[model samples]
Target: MIKNSDITVVVQGPVVASPDRAMDEGITEKCLTSVRHHLPGAHVILSTWQGQPVEGLDYDELLLNEDPGSNITEYTADGKPDASNNNRQIVSSREGLKRVKTPYAMKLRSDNYLVGDQFKFLQASFPERCEEDRFLSERVVVNNTFTRAYARSRRVALHMCDFFYFGRTEDVRALWGMSNLPDLAYDQTRNGQKQYWGAPHYKIDCTQKLLLVALQQYDASLNVEHLHDAPDDLIARSERIYANNFVIGEPELIGLGLCSKFGPQERANRLSGRLTYVNFDDWQVLYKTYCDAEFPLGMAPLRIRKRNFLRAFLLAAKLLEEALKRLKKKA
Candidate 1:
């Protein structure tokens, strides 16, 4: 069993954005409550932008300040304010790491919720480790995981999911020391900077990727391990299907309401459990059912306005093509 005294939980980043302030408070409160419940007695800290109000949530400590060298007007590659938001995460998380007095620490984004018994999963997956053996993450976002195929075809380094991370406080602090990582990565990969190469060459939002590179510069053997215990073969198969269905396939699954329930986030939540087992065949059946459903015409307007329609259309076409190819191979 993982004791609260064994670790510190840092809830850092921007407040949950909601048109309703009450809704924001409710979401923040729920996240804090969940953290406290799972890791009872763990030191909990809330770090946010300077002047941001955090009155309702209960925490052991609260730290707020503008990001070092921040310029509110600068925009990230993803279009979020650079200094105030993206850069702030690096700054706030670093500060949070410094305050951790325990051997282990977890850095969770404000909006990222831990469902069910995820704390146990963390305990079993990571456990107590020497400083050298303490690198682990919920998800490692590789170039091929979510980016466009062309972008992934290049030699861009793998990325860590910025949502949640658990490891030794020292390792976690090293990972968070990435204030100018995006620019640094861009400069190193300048040869790949072209419109055809895709967004990653220019934008450096994947701090986890940059962290790995930084760690490797000192210790070549350091690698971030996934927090789940699925067999390697199973994980590889699941990745292929997921890449096909989501990244390389189509967006019609969303219209079918299947994706909202069984999407990547849901899959992560399920797999993080101690007993949850994933069956690829079952997922295949779900995918077929989703494809058979009528394309949600009504949703197209909203999705297009949100700039996701083209990506969905392309994904759907790719999925259909892959399916047909598979049928041909079976014949």
Candidate 2:
């Protein structure tokens, strides 16, 4: 748990890149690494765009700040501009920083980089559907497994510490396979249809949901809580509908336990346990192999939005404080 004195849980990206171009600082990797590096002992979870089950990383449930060895400069990509910074007339965003949150750690992101392979666009298409579950058969899937995998504690949401960008979420380029969901959500939505590309119609929004719920739980009790208010038997039934019982659901899906009776701190504990911090891993292999050679067009993966930084920060802080009051029994 973050000390009452700690203020920022710097959040950052849902960064993107070719599988071969090196995703050293991608969202999953960033979250994993941050947890490993900063929050050392905290349990770390690796998440894909909509919560797909992919793992080469993990989080430990321990805190480093309580110790001295973990002290490091925390900043978003604030140290220097992207690779193009050396050139003149280039529009480099001076604003670069992300709020990084993990079960045991959180920080403002920095130096998170993805090797650019702008020429990989030609290879844009979903893979042949997996005979098992079509969602994972494609390149993306729902990221709810984080909770299912670590069903030991309550997982609350961490509000945006930085910007999160799901790259290629929608492919306007063609009448194609699975378009990137994140990119497509921003597209003009139809009256009824969710802005999407193909079938296997799973909707993704765990990260956002987690944050909203987490912010509301802080300082609310000595344990984790859920929803905007205490749930009567009637209201709790309703929560199961959307959350599908994920974290705060009526049945409470995607949390730390099966015996759903969270008071205050208990619920907060679950949220803290389940949050994933994006970290780095492979991508350069595919970028160099398929993307660079086959298509030579990349999405220029990034998350750009000056407007969200403050909003997310304030919301996160407010939510955390409120939850804290309840958890500490101060509420």
Candidate 3:
């Protein structure tokens, strides 16, 4: 069993100083306090930009570095996403992981905090793996919030969640130590030409890019060109990779607390007893489909069966809704 003392919690990213009276403390301070409350003996490292406020923040070590400037957002007739903090995440996480002397570590966001330590059990729970596809010695536990279930509407490949990760220090380091995102990757305009509008190019989101880069280290032959809307084969390969390398669960089950600023719609969606994202049950099914031997279909858990049924129904409704919208537009 890995004790709290053997784990270091690296809270990386910008500090969230909330002004709400309901939650008086700053998000980063609250995050550290959560670590102390849940895992008493765990070490906490706050890694953020040098100029960020740090007074009264509760952490064992403070790491400050020059801000790796944000990517430039390319505007087109078709709206492109804003500049992501991929570079910031990469630098802060890699540096923080390097400072970790403990056996296990968690890459937590400064805005996020822990509610419990139940996630530790999932770190080494799924030991069975396909030798060729196995990268990490044990599965890294990740939140299901952004871990999409591509079997449904989303067809993203290698779109692993980067929100929070808990695993062996070496494994976490390897995961975040990948190359920084290139300028051309996000900025899809050159010579005043709208490259994103009508041009053949490989585009991938930060989450997909990060995981695919790490996977490439173990299997150089693997190729993931696009972020989402991937081919079926690539999607299957992604499922296999995730099943072998990750344990995805709900935020609450994984002892994660979302910051108040993490959108109210998402918070309500979570509270509605819906299983839209890839939850632990979905991960188990993926594991069985790829890594483990197939069991009787009827033997699957009732909740999983219900979840699948609901997913199918919801997908049908979504398709119908889209069709209706198209008809309305045509009319």
Query: Which is the leading candidate under TM-score?
Result: 3
Question: lDDT tens digits, residues 1-331, model 3?
Answer: 7799999999998774323212324878888899999999999999988888899888999999788877543344344534656788888888888899999999998888999898898786676788657788778999887666542344567777788999988888888887777654444344444443113443555677677777788888777665455788877887888888888888898999987745456442553224456777778888888888753335447878887888777777776887899799999
* lDDT tens readout by residue for model 1, 1-331: 5556888888887665533222234556677787777677789988877766687778999988674543342334443443323466677788888898987777776765445434333234311222222233321111121322112112122332355556566666666765543432223333433211124324433443445455565557544332222345534433332222221112121111111233456643232220122122222332333332332234444533433444345456656877888799999
lDDT of 2 at 18: 35
For candidate 3, report its TM-score. Answer: 0.85
Candidate 3 structure lDDT: 0.76
Counting clashing residue pairs in each candidate, in order, gives 3, 102, 0
Residues 1-331, candidate 2, lDDT per residue (tens digit)?
Answer: 2331221222222234334223343455554454344433333322123332334534322121110111111111232211211110000111111112321122222223112211112122322221221111113111132322111121222212122111122210011121112222222323333332221222223333333333223222322232122235423222221122111111121111111123235542343432321111112222333223442324323321222344355457667876877789953
| Candidate 1 local Cα displacement, residue 173, angstroms | 2.0
Q: Per-prediction TM-score, please?
A: 0.51, 0.18, 0.85
- Model 3 RMSD vs true structure: 4.1
Clashing pairs in 1: 249-315, 250-315, 250-316
